[model samples]
Target: MKKRYLASALVLFSIGSLFVGVSAISPLEVFDLTEDQLHILTASRFPRLISILLAGASISVCGLIMQQLTRNKFVSPTTAGTMDSARLGVLVSLMIFTSASPLQKMSIAFIFALLGTFVFMKILDRIKFKDVIFVPLVGLMFGNIISSITTFFAYKNDLIQNMSAWMQGDFSLIVSGRYELMYISIPVMILAYIFANKFTIAGMGEDFSTSLGLNYRTVVNLGLIIVAFVASSVLLTVGMIPFLGLIIPNIVSIYQGDHLKKNLPHTALLGALFVLVCDIIGRVVIYPYELPISLTVGVIGSGIFAYLLIRRKAYEV
Candidate 1:
C-alpha cells in the first residue's frame, strides 16, 4: 500500500507539473524555454499552481484534524457549517466594510468561521444521535440554513453579483498579488503537525484524552481554530473549493490508518494531486474557456460522498 501511494504521488506530481502550462509550452519545447515562456511559468502559472497545491493540501489536512478532534469521519467545513458561516462573514464585510482592506475581510471571515465551527461542536454535544453519519447530515442542514441567510442578504443588498463571483473557485484569476493570502495555510499546517499527537488522543474520545492528562477541550478548540483560519484564507483567496476537504482525508485513511500524524503527509500529497488533476480537467473540458475548481471538485466529490453513504450500513458513535 505504501509503495502504491508513493507511485501514485509521483504520477500525480508529474502530471500536475506537465499540464500546468501546456497551452503555452509545447511538449517538445518543455525542455528548451524562451524568456516569455520563463516569465509565464514564473509569474503566472507557478504562483497559481503553488496556491492550488497548498490550498488543496492544507484544506485536506484540516478536514483530517476536524474529523479526529470530533471523532467523526463525515464532519468537514462544508458539512459542519464552517464554509457557509465564512461566506456570511464575507458578505457582511462587503456590506459593512465596503472599503475594507483584504486583511480586514480575512479577519472577519476567520471569526465567523471559528464561531460557526464552535456552534456545530456544541450542537454535536447536544444531539444524541446513535449513528455518526447522521451528525454530518444535521450539520449540512444547519449549513444550508446559514447559506440561505447569506443568500437572502446578498440578494436584498445588491451584493449577490459580487457574492456569486466569489462563490465559485477559479485558478484563472490567480496572479501574483492575488494568491499570497493562501500562504497562510503554511503556518496552520505546521501547527497541525505540531499538535498531531494530541489530536490522535483526542479522537479516542473526550474521556480517554482527559484521563491521559490532556486538556481535550483546549486541543479541540485549537484544532478548530486551525480549520477556521485555513477555510477563511482559502475562501478569501480563491473562493470556496468544495469537497476537497471532505474527500481527500477519507481517501487517504483507507490506505494509511486513522493516525493523524502518520497520515498527514500522505493526505497533503493526495489532496494536492486531486486538485491538480481536477483543475487540469476543468481547463481542458471547456477548451479556451475554463470550469471552476468548485464545480469540478463538487461533481467528483458528490459521487464519492454517495458511495461512502451507501457503503456504510451503520456508524460507530
Candidate 2:
C-alpha cells in the first residue's frame, strides 16, 4: 500500500516536472501544444525527468550495496572517494583529450573510479576494528586527498573553470543527446538486481559467506564494479549529487527492511521521488532563477543525515 503511494507520487511529480520550467505549458494544453511548447517538452523537460530518475535510482542502489558489503550504514560514494576520483579522471581527459567525446570521458572516469574504490576496500581490509563512524571518516579523508590532487592539477593546467562544471549536479542543461550516457546505468542496475542474493550473502562477512559456499572475493569485486560504473555514469551526466546514495538506502531500509532484493524497488522509487521533489524545489524557489539541484539536495540530505546520526544506535548500523 505504501509502495503504491510512492509510485503514484513519482508519476504525479514526473508529469508536474514537464510543466515547471520557464516555458509555459500546462496539462490542459498538452494536446494543443504550440510547436515551441512541444519542442520544449520533448527536448528539455523529458530528458531532465529521465536523467533524474536514472541518477536517483542508480546512485541510491549503489549506496545500498556499499553499506551492505562494508557492513556500515554510513558508507557511500560521496564519502568513499568515488566521485572525487571521477572528477580527477574528467580533469585528466580535458588536459589530454581536449576534443574527447562524452563517452571517452565516461570510460576514463569509470576506470579511475574503479581503482579508487578498490584502494578504499584495501584500506578497509587493513583496519582491525571497524568503528562505524571511523570507517567512513577514513574514506572522507581519502576522498579529500584525491580532491586536493584534482584541484592541484586543475590549477596547474588552467582547467579549473572546465572542472567547475562538474562541481555540482544540475538538470537544466540536460537535453536529448547529452544525457543518453546515463542509460548505461540502467543495464548495470539490472545486473545488480541479478546479483542481489549473492550481495546479501557477501555482506554477511568473509568467513560467513565462505562457509555458505559463496565466493566472497568474486562477489565483492563485482559489487565494487557496479558501484564504480554507476558513480561514473552519474558524475559524467549529472555532476556530483552528494548524500544521495547515502540517505536513500537508509531511509528505505528503515521501512522496507535490509534484504537487498526486497528493498531494491522501494529504494529506487523513493530515491527518484526524493530527487524529483528536490529538483522541483530547486526550480520554484526563486521563480525565474533556480537553485542548483546539489544545493537543494545537500541542504535537505544533510539535515536527514544529522537525524540518522543522532539515532544511529537505534538503527544498529
Candidate 3:
C-alpha cells in the first residue's frame, strides 16, 4: 500500500539523515556514540529532521486546505500571497521591533499572512474567468507585488541581508531550542484533520454549505487562520519552502481522490517523505556544502507543476 511505502521510506531516510551530516558519525556507531556524537545527534541532527518533517507536512496541508476552500486545485499558500505577506511581516518585525522575541515576530507574520490570504479569496470571488491556471497566475502576480514591497523596504532599511536569510528554506542551522516553534503546527494539523469534512463541504460553495447548516464564512475564516499560522511559523522557523504545499496535496488527490479527510494522512506522509528525500539529496549533491531545501523542492515541484498543468489541459480536451 502507499501508506506502507511512505511510512517505510520516511523511517529509512530519517535514519539515514541522522548519519548524513559533515560530522564523521556512522549508523553503526549510533549505539556507541561518544559524548560529541550523542550531542550532535540530540542537538543538531534530530532537530533538523523534525523541522524538515514538520515544515513539509504542515505546508502541504495548508495547501490542501486552501485548494479546498477556493475550489481551485492550483491555489496554495505559495500562490496566494500568504508566504510573501508573512515575509513582509518578518521585515516589519525586524525594522520596528528590534528587540521583539521570535514568537512576537511570528505573531505579526501570522496576521499579515491571514490578511493576504483573505484578500486573495476576495480577489478570487471577483474574478469572472476563474480558469484553473489563471487563478494561480493572478495570485503569483499579487504575491510578487507584496514581495516587491517587502524587498523595497528591506533595501531602504539596509536589512536585505537579514531578509535574504528567510528567502530560502534551510535546516543547517536547526538546533533543539531553535526548532521548538515548529511543534505548534501539530495541534493545528490535528484541528485540520478534525475539520476535514467541513472543508470539503465548504468547497461546494457558500449557499450549499449554508443549506447544510455550516456557517461558511466561519469555516473559511478558520481555514485561512490555520493556513496563515502554518505559513508564518514555517517561514520564520525554516524560511520559504516553495511548492511543498501546492504539489503534495495535488499528488495525493491524483491517486487517492479529492476528499480532504481521506487525503490528509497521505498528503502528510508523502510530503514528509518527499522533503526528507530532497534534504538527503541536497546534502550529498555536493558534499561539505548543502543546497537550500527551497532550491531542490522548487526545481522538483516546478517540474511536477508543469506536468499537472499539461495533464489538466489534456483532460479538458
Best by the lDDT measure:
3
Candidate 1 lDDT by residue in tens digits, 168-203: 988888877888988889988999999999999998
Q: Model 2 off-target regions past 4 Å?
A: 313-317
Model 1, stretches more than 4 Å misplaced?
3-23, 30-32, 314-317
Model 2, 29-107: lDDT tens per residue?
Answer: 9989899998998889999999999999999999999999999989999899989998999998999999999999999
> 87-180, model 3: which lDDT tens digit per residue?
9999999999999998999999999999999999999999998998899999999999999999999999999999999898998899989999
| TM per prediction | 0.93, 0.98, 0.99
C-alpha lDDT of candidate 3 relative to the true structure? 0.94
Q: Residue 140: error of model 1 in Å?
A: 0.8
Q: Show the colliding residue pairs in model 1.
A: none
* Candidate whose TM-score is highest: 3
Q: State, as a TM-score between 0 and 1, how close model 1 is to the true structure.
A: 0.93
What's model 1's lDDT at 168? Answer: 91
